[model samples]
Target: MNSLIEDVSPIAVDVYRSRRERVLAQLRAQGGGLAVLSTAPEVMRNRDTDYPFRHDSYFYYLTGFSEPEATLVLNASARDGEPASILFCREKNVERETWEGFRYGPEAAAEAFGFDAAFAIGALDDHMPRLLADQPALFYALGTSAELDAKVRGWIDAVRAQSRSGVRAPTRAQHLLPIIDEMRMVKDAHEIAIMRRAASISAEAHRGAMHACRPGMREYELEAELLYTFRRHGAQAPAYGSIVATGANACVLHYPAGNATMRDGDLVLIDAACELDGYASDITRTFPASGRFTPAQRELYDIVLAAQSAAIDATRAGVSFDALHQAALEVLSQGLLDTGILDKAKFGGVENVIAERAYARFYMHRTGHWLGMDVHDAGEYREADGPRDEQGARPWRTLVAGNVLTIEPGLYVRAAEDVPERYWNTGIRIEDDALVTPGGCELLTREVPVAADEIEALMRESISH
Candidate 1:
């Protein structure tokens, strides 16, 4: 059988090789250190059953090795003729393979993954001391895992014990995340391609849910539609828990228990997306369960839609992430004032409402967040004094080409004396995956209808057929 036929899609072997080379170059720049990374350990979902295992983001970013109990080591400055990239993974066991699944073992793992060498995980303890010796620095996910931390300390102690000889252990230890996280923030061509497909698949799932929705159906039924669409289109799983919220449940941000019965005249907010390969696509669409929105529901939905539109327009290169949030907030605040949700007499004006954050009563969350491999993904919002502001704090990082983020602007109106009674229990959020481009940004999750008319039309068409 051809090896290429069995390898994972979206990430080619050359992509993994280039990622390791990039990290190695950075490590060499930091004085030729030896860097170590480990995959996430398997965890139990219940008494005996194990939850599905996912590889660590940082580790997979470089090695593209998905197996658990694996570690990668990069010797940036290797001795002449020695390979710089090494992998330590589980040794193949015939019985275990029969019980659990296939094992690549070391030899095939190294060749398939483009590693310089590979060893059984059992040899990690024996190899660590030698790998740490005579290096200028040792780099790993410092303070992340106590077990890994203790293992590093043991290796260092072993190297120190050989002080009588000329051998030397690394004196400095650095955190490997900061260096690698910056690399993960920017999506490459391959990553963007995978994300685009993920986004398209997720968008179709949302459309499916919209078409399948009915007033008498349970929220979980809509969630089932999403899951079915996701799996049918080759998605691994939901990027996060599917949020199938109707009526008051939509007001709760992170509403995971989707068991409520959807009612007529209730607006359902479906905040769900799928994970394709290792990338994530996040999308949220709120529409009427009864195929037509009430007058109050349309009023609030249009406001939230306008805010999202403003935010999406502001999502361009060179603008700070905070700027997009502010743009969305401004639109939302003005909409509140226009719709009589906020009294200008008591809340002052639109500017005063935003300045005082009076809009928090209706619009609470930030406009968006970085979206990629891990959903929330890796990347810094701020850096050390890179750019200063009037308040003497570092400003949010500016958007750059290749940065993919979510533009989510939401509004939730709970019953209050100041709030209109008709708008009570109305919650709506419009979110889409956006990629920064040279001109502006591309909307990755735009296939689904967001406009009230379009959503109702789509639902009507589905019902008619």
Candidate 2:
């Protein structure tokens, strides 16, 4: 019979192998330990309808297995000499596949995903204790997947009960996050490749939106064009919700309504997103609904563009993640002062008195976030002391080669009686996915038009053609 699961891409397969080796090395460094990991379970949004199933980000990072209810166990012991990773996945069920979809059972999972050992899901309870029998430390996220957490607790408890027969269970059960997150921070070649592709698709999607958007069109209609570009170009789906904001609707951050009418002279802030092969790309761009910016709109747009450029420049090896945010804030804060939105005399010391607070009213969100399997990707950035310490911090320690992230800086001004009349109903955001490298940072979405002139030319080209 023909297999429904398309052959896993080489890039995805390589990612799985690299992550496994990393976990093994970490376990070996720990002087021998075992870690149990599981993908998130399918969640129900309503009867017979399931919220899109996304594998646990961590699990997906390590195994590249998108299937739900799967478990991965790393068995490492000083006594055994080396560590091995075993994957447990759904067994062949023809009837179930006929109903829901096809699944790669253990044998197929082993061959396709490059696991050292493979077992059926039904064997987890029977096999887990045996794997953990004498491990001295357990590595796993304790409270994440409740059902899997309970199952893991039961398995550990059983192993603990056998403490009498010289079979000592893990004396310490540390959270798996830090160990795994360290590996995820510096993406390997394969991950970078996938992210580059994701960014390309995302950039194309944003360009599509910019070209299709018109003054009288509904925001959702613009969103539809973006999605069409995503699927047509082989993106799995949006990395996050598509934010299509027009007019005053742009003032509402996290606005997903996307149903408002885009009026002439308004800037359409499309935070269009896309993902490919599980690697994520988040991009945002503001376009003039009339195909050309007004004097006031151009002023704010150039400020944001400059801020975004400064922020991207700040992404480099050894530069603190906070540095980029601060750089962006400096640009935005001063822009506000220059535009008369902020009174320099009254707020003269605001930027100095408060770090990042002076611009918080207008720029509410963080300058950027880690981009990976999830959009607001996981991995802790700050240390326990709230400082950047690579040794102690997993993800946000420092920008390193191979790490992919977004630098998005935005300004939103809602309509108000006292507010500057010209600034009302204006929202501007510019975002780009960057890859930190040894020499400098590479802008992944550079192919997409960003400069005001470039964007206008692209829009004009589309209209003329």
Candidate 3:
């Protein structure tokens, strides 16, 4: 952890507090219950070392506190004496504090995080039975955590043991994430601000990667540049494994940056981004390692760029999520036909190729996905409980204001007798973060050049400098 973490609270305390209140209100409406959630446990990476601890998204949504072995208990059925929100966390130990940074203890955590009450984590088992007794319902994800499930059962059993004394466990249990996911999908102003900054930071990293790229550089060297740029720009880390694929390696979608040397005639596909605070921004750009795209490569690049443009154009309030993907797919299908990547005589037309998925040889994967705290952020993609269409699928959810997603359309041509030899081993992907608005959508990762000519210009500038 760095000092940057202390500054992670760009969203005011009231935002998390308000979310907790909303969860409590939902619980109260559903016959009142206690909702219990625990932060992620710190896992041991090896014999003595430990993996970097990350707080659980669900727990952090309600409480901004970022400590492991912490649990939040919200009692919707609290009486006049009981507080609505309670947090139980690791007890303070001076010896442990000397080794492991700070622990809020209980009183400090309650005050710092706006909880009504708090206690040591050690007391949770002792207190859960009393908290669960006679509640109408319990709210938590049922099967996500085996450890949490075992603890929940023990609490329920403890309440059951008191049945002779006229106490009863909760009668019903509800999954909590669906409600939370719904809340998380729509980016509020605070979240959007963080995401915007993240996008800016990541855009700079991409630019840096392009600048450092050159002929005869190993793929890993370009990757190192990306990582250095991310951290240098105050980002905690890369959003995901930085994909710095060079030459034919670009054909592998999730190719890890390795020892493959970037050659003069090859293209590098960089699918990377950065994380700021907790939100993630994703961007992918493909460009020539020699600072110039060949005719064949430039043609593929233009097609993917045009497809991304179509998808971005279709992204707005009231459009289905799938509609944006369809928009990109149509453009890409047409591009494949024009380029001879998909035989026009065999595929007939763009619609026929799409219906048959004949263009899948060079283009696969969806156009984009929901993006936020997690790269593939939470939220149902399709309409819940809607009647199945003739495709036997539920309708995709319509886009609304505050929804953020990615518009990434790509083409990967592999060596095949059926494929044009000139287009072989070329991969191009143009990705940008799209924030849906009333008019259309805002492109977040536009700081980096996506246009083929612009990329060549940026690379030339990089080489001269």
Candidate with top lDDT is 1
Model 1: CA > 4 A from native: 1-5, 8-11, 387-392
User: Compared with the true structure, what per-residue lDDT tens digits does model 2 show for residues 1-465?
Assistant: 334445676667776787788787888788778888888878999998999887888888888888887998887663454338789999989999899788889988877888877999999899878888878888888777687678778988898788787676777877888887777777777778888888888888888887787778998898889889999999978888899998888888888945789888888888877888777888888888888998888999999999998898888888777888888888888888888777677678546524537677788998888877778776666643554345665344667787778899999987767557899989988888888887668988887888998888888887887
Model 3 agreement with the true structure over 1-465: per-residue lDDT tens digits: 335335535446788899999999988888899999898889999999999887887888789888898999999999898899999999888899899987878887777678899999999999899999999999998799898899999899999999999999999988988988999999998899989999998899889889998899998898888888888888888888889999899999989889999999999999999888778999999999999999999988888989988898899999899988899999999999998888889888999989998878778899999999899899999989788999899989989999999998899999999888999999888899999999899998899999888999999998898
lDDT of 1 by residue, 308-381 (tens): 88988898998887888998998899888887889978876778998888999777788888899989999888
- Quick one: how many clashes does candidate 2 have? 0
The better-scoring model by lDDT among 1 and 3 is 1
Mark the regions of model 2 whose C-alpha exceeds 4 Å error after superposition.
1-6, 9-14, 78-83, 163-166, 349-356, 383-396
The residue pairs found clashing in candidate 3 are none
Candidate 1 clash pair list? none
**Arrange candidates by lDDT, highest first: which order?**
1, 3, 2
lDDT of 2: 0.82
Which of the two candidates, 1 or 2, achieves a greater lDDT against the reference? Answer: 1
Each candidate: RMSD to true structure?
Answer: 1.5, 3.1, 1.9
